[model samples]
Target: MNTILNFMKRNYKILVAILCLSVVFFAFNSNAKKDNDPERDKLLLELLTFVIEKGHYSPAAIDDAFSKGVYKDYIQALDPSKRFFLQSDIDEFSKYETRLDDDLLSKDLTFFNLTYDRLMLRMAEGKKVYKAILSKPFDYSIDENFNTDYDKAPYTATAAELKDRWRKQIKLSTLSSLTDRLKIQETKAKGTEETSEVKSDSLEMDLLDKAKSDKGVENSAPKTFEELEKETRVSAEKSLDEYFGFMNDLDKNDWFSVYINSITSRFDPHTNYFAPEEKERFDVSISGKLEGIGARLQKKNDYTEISDLISGGPAWRGKQLESGDLIMKVAQGNGEPVDVVGMRLDDVVKKIKGPKGSEVRLTVKKVDGTIKIISIIRDIVEIEETYAKSSVVEKNGFKYGVIYLPKFYIDFDDKGGRDAGKDIALEVERLKAANVDGIVLDVRDDGGGSLSTVVDIAGLFIQEGPIVQIKSAGRKKEVLYDRDKKIEWKGPLVIMVNSFSASASEILAAAIQDYKRGIIIGSKQTYGKGTVQNVIDLNQFVRNSAMGDMGALKTTTQKFYRINGGSTQLEGVRSDVVMPDRYAYLKMGERDVENAMPWDKIDAADYTIWNDNAKFKQAIANSKMRISQNDQFKLIEDNAKWIDSRSEDNTYSLNIDKFKTAQSSIEEKAKKYKPIYEYKNSLKFNSLPNEIDALNKDAILKEKRERWHESLAKDIYVEEALNVLDDLQSKAVTTKAMPVKIKKGKLAKS
Candidate 1:
């Protein structure tokens, strides 16, 4: 989701000069009485359009086609479920569809102003509709069905029709919850405490509790069907109330961001406008670190509640701050406490977060109803989930290392800070020290980050080579290379990817595949995001203006390609060994995106393939043969086909009996694939010595690692990856009967 570019240093002067020259004709008048600053909005529109037009890799013409695309996307984003806007409202909005291009050019806010005002009005009416619909109990005996295909569903013509639509929506939700609750009761009556459905429901409820901090139904005693049905209504009402509460918190600025994004995304799917707060969040996500107390807060009605704590955060270590606790006030150091109750969530967060080593004191009402003040020293909290983690597993008399990179993270401001490339190199060193026979680099769901990190990570497996090719608009392709001669991992290497793997992930996979340095496994192809984006801070362009923050823009500035000349754009790197995925047929990749950049090829980079991996071809053949004959894999393929067929099965019966029967049939059919989750391998995974030491100190960290290791034990794909690694081992090395030298416990240098 992030890309490498030091635009602040390299392109700042040019951008500012461009903005200064372009803004001479743009005149704005302030309206202090307006809800949103009209002058600021106009300036922002002017700045955004000029910046994108000049910087984008291939900017789309701001013509009628672009205007139409923006109109469709914006309207859909505003009311995706088609519950807020009426057909009459859409008819009125359609008048300006093609005229939006003129609005953008002249910085006219006519379309945006009309739509924003209308949406606010409609949303206010929608709040009334849903509340009234949920107020009355839905009759489950009615022989009716509801279609969840909101995209095709026509907007209601009148208030009466809208109410009926809302009723069906609410009824369907409550009916599903009612069925789940009734099933739990039935299972309890049957004395079946360990049913998979029960376990799944329990997990779902537990997750909801953590997310909402909602005190769920009181006691575990079995309830009558009537009581369960009422509970379902209460749950649905509470969920809708919370959703509307969040909607109420959004201001005109937030809506304006959406409107801006609708315009930006017309250039490409990845191009987006980030508000100031959103920009901060994007930075945290890319860096995987933040300067805060390390506790996540959510608005619960009028109170700000602690939802979760980062594992290694100051609040977590303090132990006084806990999830479900409500914050009443926040004070910086010994300053006077500010009442944060009923305040905006963003304002509350601003009050709570401070620079590292600063102290923030919070007055909180505990879950037990006792009030207490807890002072926490804010520090740099690294999100463990963002970093690459490895587990050493013993399989077939050899230790194989599995390293999972959640994303290609990097701290752009800090050159010495942790990045995917460096962390991966450290993991390789650790695995080598553990005497691992081979390594599996898992980037299954990695959406990618720093472009530089991809080169660094890919370089670890090869001695020296051109990693990837990059091409900007109207420019010659530039080849990025790994000039380093030291290969951190020269032994058996396998890179695991899925359809979610994208951008820098595709680059790494394609590079390794091109060099024949490692085998690429899993998914038919990756997420197919080949374009690179750079975040442009808009505040830098304006000088000393009272317009406040202008936020930032992330736009596609270049396209990346594999060393073999082909762009990974829509045709993401094809796997060397394809695996059956349940969601394989889902239209979730970049290729499915309507406005995605087209795929094209360039001249190949000059590089020699790694000739040392003699068993690579045989290993791939052996894996294919094993997977072809495996019953589990065959079942997985069948499940995939079943899932693809069921993708359109979005309608459900409203009658209680019919719903139960349909669900029961599904549960029975799902039982056939139960082996997928239950299957466990003989291999046992363990943490490295350093992680083991840290795990012993942190119970939360220990639990996370244990769960991950357990999941790895149940992963058939990982087991197959190990099988490939087994086949990939050099035969001559094994025949020599040479003992791997060990210095005490760690493996000696090869």
Candidate 2:
């Protein structure tokens, strides 16, 4: 979801120069003498404001307009559902709306203090309101409605009105759950097996044997409507209790982070502050590796529940820890087990996550009501989904390769480690080894990562050329070029993109399109994010600071443009062959943001458009004509329109009969589009020889590849991309150049 700048060497030098000047100024003035929470907070505000003002690519003027934007965004973020603060609280808070800019300039904390304390009070009151409403039986016969359009709904004026609002909301939830349970019971009574897709929490749990063993399977037997109704209320109450428990785990710093982000985001959607823990998570996300047991945990009231295990990690390989298992105690090797039942989830994670090769034992309560201890040797686990993977498919007696790059991943710490560029080159080499006729590089849902990787990847298809242009404020534009003259694959190439493809993804797609080296296919346009960001460590500016881990700031430092001199800021790359998308009617691109940067153009870079493919234009025309007459695609277009029409239907009834009737009508119409998910392209996707050998040894990897290949078989978009590749096939033998050296100076296709 972010782009890394290639000017790290220069960027850090610039930061050091500005930060030293700020440090000298801070030494002369002493506003908050004491080293307390408030003092550290004030220092953070000072450092954050100064860094962004000096470092941001296009720093917005900190005027009344900016203040108002922060005020609205912060208030909305605090109470997005409008279930906490009453109208009076908002009225009082609105007085300082335009004065936040002045307060920020003066380093004042009046507005933040007042709002944070008031939010705390309101949340305590909200806990009571929900508890009181769920304490008794709800009257399903009552004719009432609840609108989920919270943005447009007015806040309640009084406590009584707010209480009534809670009542109707809870009533609608219980009524819906009650009806689903009733249907399941009816199906059971008719000697028919109940469907696993029921909406009731307790009923859904019944499908798992673990639930039957722990909660008693007898509970799933046909129950009276009264019994089901009461259970619904209990389930609703338990969910609220768990939610409040999670909220209570958040200390003052967590809320302060939220408040800080509201201000930072006003400059741009991609710019924000990251706390210490959040920064660590961001690093893991981009690098796709972490040293731990590699299991995701969730806080369920008192116990830490194992949500899912990373496929190739220690826990997954151990084959002991399971999804429903609850960790009761954690202990280091040969150390006494420490109780983690009532501990915060973060604290539990801190206990479990350790250096690589360390041993940790966990005493877990199995779902079958048995207590057992399991030991695991922690190691560096690579998230398989984050890397690029390729699958080969046979179409019309020719082999085609499909490579899906989830993100442009890179390990900033270890330059020699795996990255998107290195992995993609290896995938291309593997596909070439398999004698593939064409290749489809799918970048769908890829939000983007390292900017340098885009250049390296785009270089694989073409000889030497500029891939993208980057511009800094008040500076000349710099064109990033691939100097390597060797091409790995000289076959038909197609780049697939959608609305979610952004930043680095856009840069790659735009370069390929401008070069005429590949045909762009998928959604009408991409996510329209053309900005570059650099994460600055705040601790580097402060000397002898008592505040532990000052965290980091990711800010927009530049904007990238296509080699054709066009900015993908607002108008992302338009697909050569457009496809229908379900969320097309929604405002989802960078242009949808209120304060997004405007689009502009620069001088085009000197590059030659590839003219080797003779049937490139004919392939595009053939695919467009085929899509126009396809029945499945027409049905997809109709479904997209139908989905858009239903976006505004947010209100639901509390009356049981009315609610059920309305839901039935919607479900009946939805059944007509069910075939969309079931549609298969009848293509067989397979792994290359190397991957097949690895998959045979690793069962987990085998299952993952099987699932991925199955998904590719059903993807109609991929089917079309393959069709385009088929049409682009040339009788003229392509001049396959020698493979160039990849990242880390290793020749992958030598």
Candidate 3:
């Protein structure tokens, strides 16, 4: 389910492009094939390949080289951990390594079929091996280690070797569970006067014997190693069961998606293919509103389990549906109940979600082992919970505003729909009414949304200017501009971004930096996704086709550049005040993505730099000095370095005693970093007076605001941003206002 969701998220721009592009009708074969048929898949492949070749901005040639790339990606996608397939399987599949392009061109599935069949066989073998390994108790006293870095590990060469690998994997999983349980027990036993004096070797035997007894075991003694082992085995079994169940649920379309993505991704990372169901999921994510029981569902051991309940949603209001509850069956109003056990999570969701005000019944098994039928009236679950929101932060008698934009979200189909720009403008107005001294625009972890919305938001800062330059293959560069001359906020501005901030986020930040409108702060660079994608409906491309709702194809149509000529492609927007972040040393950008478009530049768009640019140099210097002297900043740097070092150490001891000792040592070391979490800014944040009435009326809104304020008080990044804003504000007040001038040459420096 997570894999499918990730596929939708990465391919979201395709749905956006689908709405933006005018649907052009083309001739299609009337008698192609029915849905779910192999012929339909072949037709889909042909259509997808044709679309990529003709529509993609930088389509790779369909040659042996491309085929090899696809083959490697496809294999990796199939078994990324290199656990399911063996070296021999890879060797066998290598015959079609450079022949995939030929097969795709001919719409042949011979390679796909062979690989699929092999995967099924390997998975069955894996299930047997895991079950056989877990059937008996594991000896945690063995001195062995397991390397979790699967990329560096070689595939097993024999069945015995594969079983051994599975055994070690199972042991590692079980050891983690055992250690966690032991810690919990130790914590619980801390205040107790009586303590068990059971030896490590005899603990399992005693626990096994106690298990054979009655209720006296719980009250008479603490749990032994045998009980913990039993519990861990049960959990491991359930996990494996759920995994294989999910794997079994994958139809040809699922596998086809993997293959199609491999091909599309060769052109660029953003280009993708979305099945019809996947497109719906993308819409739900973007719209942030769905008519349903708003409970996050996950597949757990052949049952649809409620993982989380959205705050203020229907499920939350019901109070009966809780996390970890297993959904047994789903039924419509006054209808016969349909068992949902073993059903696909998407199918279960479809059964549960209905029109607003509609009733859906769910027979759920609670985590406490009680079963009940709970009926919930479905309402519009406002994913407004995921939208842009703001809070007023007060520091040193100055009230500053922090607006966190999760994405540049917009419903392209609905002009009057919720927009990030409008929401942000409203937030700015609310902050202005409260008389904020400055504002921090937080775009951290925002992967970006609508391009038009980003332009509108950028316009709110600057009076009027070109925001970004876009260029398609063999086409003249088109510069997107802020036509509106009205400035929404003239006070000091700070835009906060991180490694996850990409595309539209980069555009907004770059435009602000290019014009010296605001100080961009955070990690060294953003996600650096500069390309634009357009999702074209395959059905529209092939008119009157019997293939039945051919999924959309998202193709990279253009590449966007900052107004200052530099493309935010592999090289994302650089921050003015660089700070050490967890991802600072991590390879997590467009450059890290496979086949990401190379960075380049074009002529700078005609724009004038803000007259306040002179203040940035000194302000940046002051910020650097403060960060260098601050204890919190020092702790953050140390923590980031420690995390990076830990990330490099993938090998883990399998022995229970050694594993526990290692975990304890790490925990002891982690205690020193606890000060990082305890570090709190002196800033006091609050909701605007105008919003107080609304917030008071809406309990969920009030709760969200309180949570946001609490988080802001602890956020070191926002504190630093506020400090930057302070310096900018003070500089503005001390220095004389410079006359606005239009510079014709190079862009301003940060």
RMSD of each: 5.5, 4.6, 5.5
Model 1 per-residue lDDT tens digits across residues 1-750 = 566554224354665687778767666453333347888888889889999998889999999999999999999999998888889989999999999999999889988989899999988998888878777677999999999999999999998888788888889888888877667657756887644554334434654344344445543456677776776777777778888888888999999999999999999998999999999999999999999999999998888999999999999999999999999999999999999988889989989988999999999999999999999999999999899999998877888999999989999889999999899999999999999999999999899999888889988988787888888787677778899999998799898999999988999999999878899999999999999898888887765356778899998888998887889999999999998888888898999998999999887766767767668889999999998999999999999988888889999999999998998888889889888878998888999998988999999999999999999999988988889899988646443322333232234443
Per candidate, the number of residue pairs that clash is: 0, 0, 0
Candidate 2 lDDT score relative to the true structure: 0.87
* Candidate 3 collision pairs: none
* Whole-model lDDT, model 3: 0.81
Off by over 4 Å in 2: 27-36, 190-221, 334-336, 732-750
Pairs in steric clash, model 2: none
How does each model score on TM-score?
0.94, 0.94, 0.89
Misplaced by over 4 Å in model 3 are 1-35, 192-220, 312-326, 332-336, 355-379, 544-546, 697-700, 730-744, 747-750
Highest lDDT: which candidate? 2
Model-by-model lDDT, in order?
0.86, 0.87, 0.81
Worst 10 residues of 2 by lDDT: 741-750
Output the lDDT of residue 313, model 1: 97
Sort by TM-score, top down from the best: 1, 2, 3
